[model samples]
Target: MKPKTSALTIAAIAIVLSYLLILAIQQYPTIYRRHVDPNSETEKLPYQTYLATFLLFTFDELVKGNFTGTILKLKELNQTYVPTSLKYIFERFRQLLNELTLKLDDTDSQLDYAEHLIYSGREDDAINPLKVAGYNLAESNITYSQLKSSAEEFTKSFMLPRTQFFQKIDSIQNLIENMYIRLQALLERIEFQKNLEETYLEIQVYPENVWVGSTITVEGKLYTRTQPLTQKNVILYFDGQKISETRTSSNGLFNYTIKVPYTYKPKANIIAKYLPVEDDSNKYKPTTSNTVQISLLYITPKVEAKVLGKPLPGKHFTLEGKVYAERILPYNQIKVSWLTSSITTQLENGTFKLTLKVPETISDGKYILKAEAPPSKIFAPTSTTLYVNVQRIPINLTL
Candidate 1:
């Protein structure tokens, strides 16, 4: 049987719990400061110890104490019922991660919007806040079944639970979801602001660009985010492939070098990356450069041929020529031919000698004198064409 709660009873408990949660969150930071303070004495040490002891039980107890406090509240409220143990913590943690994933996704989208608005010179006209409000209403991560289960247990302990278990859980979960949504939105905005503040990309590499299988000097100039006067460290990567490494000078300057090597494969890629670090060398990040593509080619064989010439018809003539390869073939392996009116040649060894009978057709025209080699031989095809006025040449030929 379910009990009914009056408005007055519910309000008192909510106000008390809400106040406690807020106070706990507010005090946790001061508690953290005392412990982390290097120079603090006895008083600070005790507070630090106390805070440490509380967090020793759970990690979340350190961060705004949301998970620990929620667990404690549930334990106290359900004390009369058998408490769920180690198994329950795992279940809740899984559920928390699931809820957080949705929240983080929402945060990412909202951050994108905020970034666009801020950069677009529309700060005054930004609808981010309004849009977030609408988004919160549309998507609350809390489930009614979960709320009902919790509420039924909670209501069983109290005398008057006026609203149904489902409604009560819905209302409280709605409030929690709204706070989570708002927190996520705020964090995203803060990130956007941080990015805006450090807007310039102060990175330089000597020989600013490089070809694949080449090396270039790299230097960096970046202001430290936390330590302004001190220079930051820089690390670089090639698509996460470790490349060159170097540290920036104390004057906010860094220089180093890296090279891309040629691989036996047909193609390869080169990429640049920038990673910045502080005084703490162990703390570093690797950023990627735009990818560069490289390609290679193969070599071909070389060939050359040697050839000879001829004379006109009806002319007293003698001709001689030679055909040879720069790369000497051990055998007489070339084929040669003569073209013209009344032209003939004799091939012996690698040379040709010719005589012309001077036919009537041998006047004023062009003729192709040809010499060719077979496939088994390595010589390229060779030819020469001559324009001749055979009538002007009716009397003479030379060797």
Candidate 2:
């Protein structure tokens, strides 16, 4: 029985020792891996693998035009220690990114310059900038293709499948092609505009001197180098303000009669302009006629006076009259004078009324009463006279 027990105990001890040996064998690899030097060649494989993966992610981000994300990733990658074997690859990527960034900036600047030229009405000058932009985009596209090929080769070296980065490149290429097509179309349009004929406008104003509120004739003709432009619209400007619009007749002549606006200036400027519209906008360039100036005359108010009845001495009497003119007088008062007696009264709606009294000491007689409108900036002074008879109050005497 003791031999049997000893043999069993030896078998149990052998089983425990074998289990401990297997456990130690498994733990030895973990402990060794944990203690491996991070900078050693053995650890370089995983580090390079991580770098390659991160580079692919950054490449994809750049292809997607995620500049902000690409920059952040590039910063992180820069901080990482690159192995000597991959330094040239990183340098190439850095150079490619820098070139692409510069190309993009150049393209943006050219586009801005072209837009500014267009807004400044220099479409002819804008074409060069647009062409430069297109060239820059084309160069960028070539650079992008090179970058894509390099990335594809790097991806394949890692035995990785083609990613959406390739698809993004295709999209960017398509966009660039579309931009080129649009630029070509714009250039064609500019060339067409450059070929369009210039327009000439001739105008004459009748009655060089006119009163305010009076009509004056504005006649003009629109023509090109070869022939007149009939049925075209012509606009007339009075003192820099648009006053009337007319269409050219069969002879390419337009006539517009516009009333002179009431103004305090001594003279006004008249101009005729022809602006192309609809199909004409593509056919002809806009033009303006010579500036014509005309003298502005003020209207003289005609004054007429009448007494309501024979006025008794020392009694009030009504003197009323209508003031006629080409325009209403801005002034509100009219002056009346009668043999050393004078009064100023209000005028309403081109007419005036006044209350006057004859001196009691004056003997009864016939006298001339006058009504006058004082001269103003926009009204000429005028006066009219009326024969007025004055008498004393009748006296009844008791004897």
Candidate 3:
């Protein structure tokens, strides 16, 4: 009876330790979701295996109370200790992601992103591939003419969901769950350091000017700051005097109306302030916002209209709109030429720098456009015509 009991106990212990050892081994150097071959995004973390190893390492170091083995074993696999430290940082990572999940509520289209957050591991940063692909394609050196067709081909070259975005999240979650015990343990250590000193990134505001009692949007980078910025404290002001204080969340951005006080209307200044980190001693020292001058004499000017792209048979000609208003009137704004034969529609801010594709709607043949602002408006009007030769080839927008 004693021998039988001893054999059973040994078998159970072996099974548990074997699982633990495997988990620890899997995340040795760095786990990756995609293979480490050429012609792909390799920096993307290996979510599932990394999480499994993380959980295993954490349990060994904390719950099992074995630190030396965790350190030594991890060190043998790689020279870096970031992976081992992840064991302690997993919970914080989880919390940050949970907050990210809440951001889905801000937009009706991010329910799947929320789900990805539910089971997301620290290494699983590829939650939104379409966004990733879009950003990548946009940032590429390719021109707008080349982007409308060939750009989409590189979408799958990167991780994240191309179409079934939510499904990608589900897939990532399920893959990690396959080894749930390891994944949970792996999330023990996840730390992020936002070194704001001399950030390589930049944030600049246009017009750098504002007016009292005017609708001045603090436009720059709504998501310019780093992570953990959501829920951070904020303070807005003019000429060093505190005007308003607000908290940022979801988007880590701010764009609100500031009722310019009548007390200081003489060339008022707009400034934004925020506490990026409160836990540290230097956190109370709020970062001053990019300054902008609020003047009462600025007038928005009119824009020139023009046709965009080569019109094809059975395709509508796209028109690009530009508002070249140098001196905009105080409290006066500009609008898009939606009712006219404009190819490019300009944004309200007059920074009309958008590249749009025309759809197949207009009939084949020559099309004319009166692209101009009338005398009543600040802009002078103009007209042009586009000739489409559909007799040669079929309509192919991709071309």
Candidate 1, residues 1-399, lDDT tens digits: the string is: 124556677888999999999987773333334548643522221233332333233223312325445456334323322223333532443354334334434544564565445433234334665367345434544433443454343334332232543343344455545556655664554444443323112444445334444665555554535543234334455544556555556765666666654333344444433343343313322233344444422121122332233445555444445655555534443343445333334345656655434455565664444444433222334433333334444557798
Put down candidate 2 lDDT per residue, 303-362, tens digits, no spaces. 887889679888788888988887767788888888887888888887888778877787
Candidate number that wins on TM-score, 2 or 3:
2
Q: Give model 1 RMSD, 1 decimal.
A: 33.4
Q: Please say which candidate is ahead in lDDT: 1 or 2.
A: 2
Off by over 4 Å in 3: 1-211, 220-228, 263-266, 280-285, 297-399
Per-candidate TM-scores read 0.26, 0.39, 0.22
Question: Model 2: residues >4 Å from true position, as ranges?
Answer: 1-35, 43-81, 157-161, 197-281, 284-399
Q: Estimate, for each residue in 18-124, the C-alpha lDDT of model 3 and write its tens digit.
A: 99999987855434455565334334333544544543443234223233444444444343233332423433333332322222212223323422332222123
Error of 1 at 283 (Å): 18
Question: For candidate 1, what is the TM-score?
Answer: 0.26
Error at 29, model 1, angstroms: 62
Output the better candidate (1/3) by TM-score: 1
Q: lDDT rank, highest first?
A: 2, 1, 3
